[model samples]
Target chain A: MNVEFINPFLTSLLNVMSTMASMELEPGKPALKTDPIAKGDVSGLIGMVGPQTKGSLSITFERELILTTMQKMLGEEHEEIDDEVTDLVGEITNMVTGGAKNILSDKGYEFEMATPMVVTGKDHTISHKAKGKKIIMPFSSEFGTAFIEICFEH
Target chain B: MNVEFINPFLTSLLNVMSTMASMELEPGKPALKTDPIAKGDVSGLIGMVGPQTKGSLSITFERELILTTMQKMLGEEHEEIDDEVTDLVGEITNMVTGGAKNILSDKGYEFEMATPMVVTGKDHTISHKAKGKKIIMPFSSEFGTAFIEICFEH
Candidate 1:
């Protein structure tokens, strides 16, 4: 798997959310976090294909983190999570992928993305094809914890 | 203008419909024809980026075409076009782009896409911008007239 293929997407996602929500995100190391019930958990998954093989990008966040982020986006406090909130999260992932795709296009890598699917709940495991490497970048914000996962086969 | 990019997308769309609807689409040159008002005119647009400059792909159709397509998809005659019909057309565009992206990615072109936005009207003009090269593929089916436009800069 090309780490280069994954980095731009993660960076763009962070930049978009940070700008949209006006929330500060603390950057940390890229490593997979396996805890199912982590604080604010919202996950977005999108598949990609190109030179190498097919794979997916999954971004997960604790519930609280997403609520605060959504609050900032909608300018309203949300106590209960519903379709609107989930849709917003899915749209965010779609935008991030779009931004990343634009940048990668300049690098001579043309990648198309699938419509994003959003999943919310604890103890839900996302499985990717058992090839290549898994890279996870975890972030801590005033709102909550979030991570981006890239699974691909080189 | 790369006809290579355009041909695959159009073919994939026909292929998907053929497999799903069991209807054989006669291969013909891209041209213009008078379209009837079946259900209503529905259009969706989403932007793309990569080796080329900024551009968008749009899919439009009449209400009748949508109803017929949806009927094939759902295996039933729908009395009227509703939310499900609208979503099905939007999803068709998404799937077509997803397939095209796979080919582009393999060639090392990188870009992102915006969420699909649905629009309704009659005789709407769809535009594309690519290095000052603009091409519009107008289509007329049993339902109505629709087209896809690609514009980008090299």
Candidate 2:
């Protein structure tokens, strides 16, 4: 995958978190994902396809981190992973992906993004048959750690 | 969703099963799905997005049905759901979606499809926040029952 295709997602994620939740995040080293399971209790996935690329974006969040982030994001308290929490996860995924799409479209990569799909379970894995290089970007915020996984075939 | 947009999928699914697995199938009346859980142990999801439509297609098969379908499709006997089974599910999803995309494209609905995403577990649910009408088309075959869910926003 081209690093140029990944920069937008990183920028969008950091921008979304800081703007929406008022949480500053520091990104760790991006690495290849060897494991199958998404390293979180909940994940939001958005699929992307263009003339030259096909990929999917997954943002997995630890349970406590999402709960805390959502509470702060919504200006309310969420005691558990209710419908609101799930919706928040989906919205966050959409916003980040849509933000990336805007930048990518301007760069002449015309693509369409599917609606965000939220999957919740322990040890659940999302396997995409894109045969792309899978990169995992881990970010840390005050609430906790989360990961942005991008698998792109160019 | 417009029936024009959905007919291609139904036709492709029936055609894929018959041509790929040599299995004849009967589709039940499509019904709107209000529940969150995809009603199967394994599911193949393909997301679709275009100028006029944004949604997903999920084909959930009973474990036995998939195992048997794989056995018939590949001329092999499989007792359990291994990586091959998972791979077959993704391929089937891809083929069906690709077939449909071809027809839809000919009809002027040019869209890009994401690579198939396979979700496997005992009791797992895939929640999409598209707010579209989710219609599940159930089919009964000699092996068992499966469903093709199309959630499209036009």
Candidate 3:
């Protein structure tokens, strides 16, 4: 796992959250996660592949943060996990990944991204489609907490 | 969605079931699915990327069939959906997609496959990463029924 490949996601996550949701976030120390069980109640995951590398990007968001972020971004009040929450999560995943994709492309790691999927459940498991180090970047904000997972195989 | 690209998945699915799990599968009519909710209790999904094309492949299996298939393949009895069931489903997804990948690559559609993800839950939603028509091929046997979903973007 190259630190070069991971910085883009953390940077992009910060960019997306502050710019998109007007929430400033501080990134906690990134760590390797061996378990597939999700830490949040809702998640959005997408796959990435290029000629030189293949990987996956995902955001597992706690319910409170998701609801608050949704309120900030979409002006909707969501009480529970529903279609709108998942849909919004999917869009957030796309934007976050897209931001990273551009930064990576500028660095010569050109790849195409797949559609994002949103999974919602307590104790849900997300098996990433990439075989490599599963690194998680946990972020904290005034709203709540969220995690960004990136699996890069170079 | 061209039937040309879809046949490989169905063919690979039947072949994988027969050769890998010793279950004979009869593929039903392939149809378009707009809904994201999965029909079965568990599912495995993978994404595909190439210079010219991008898509995703997935398999959703009934609990009964998964347990039975595990019994036949691993000679272990599993009455519940746990780590073993999800792990086996991930392997099946890999083999099925690998078979399809070879067929597609031989036809000059060279691409790379991402690792497969196993998702377990009743009515869980699987978001395909590719933006295109989603075609689902249903297969039935004495064991039970499973679905192969292929989303191809050209």
DockQ of 3: 0.52
Cα deviation at A30, candidate 3, in Å, is 2.1
Candidate 2, A112-142: lDDT as tens digits: 8888777776655666666887888889877
Best by lDDT: 2
DockQ of 2: 0.63
Model 1 lDDT per residue over A1-154, tens place: 5667778977887788878988777778876533222223456656565554545666777778888888898887777556567767777877887898898888888666655545554533333332456677778886677877766654
DockQ of each: 0.03, 0.63, 0.52
What TM-score would candidate 2 get against the native? Answer: 0.88
TM-score of 3: 0.88
Q: Residue B100 CA error for candidate 1 (Å)?
A: 18
Chain B TM-score, one value per candidate, order as shown: 0.77, 0.93, 0.94
Candidate 3 C-alpha error for residue B64, in Å: 2.8
Q: How would you encode candidate 3's per-residue C-alpha lDDT over A20-100 as one tens digit per residue?
A: 888888899888877765567888877787778878877988889999988998899999988788888888888998998
Ranking by lDDT: 2, 3, 1
TM-score of every candidate relative to the true structure? 0.48, 0.88, 0.88
Per-residue error (Å), model 2, residue B45: 1.8
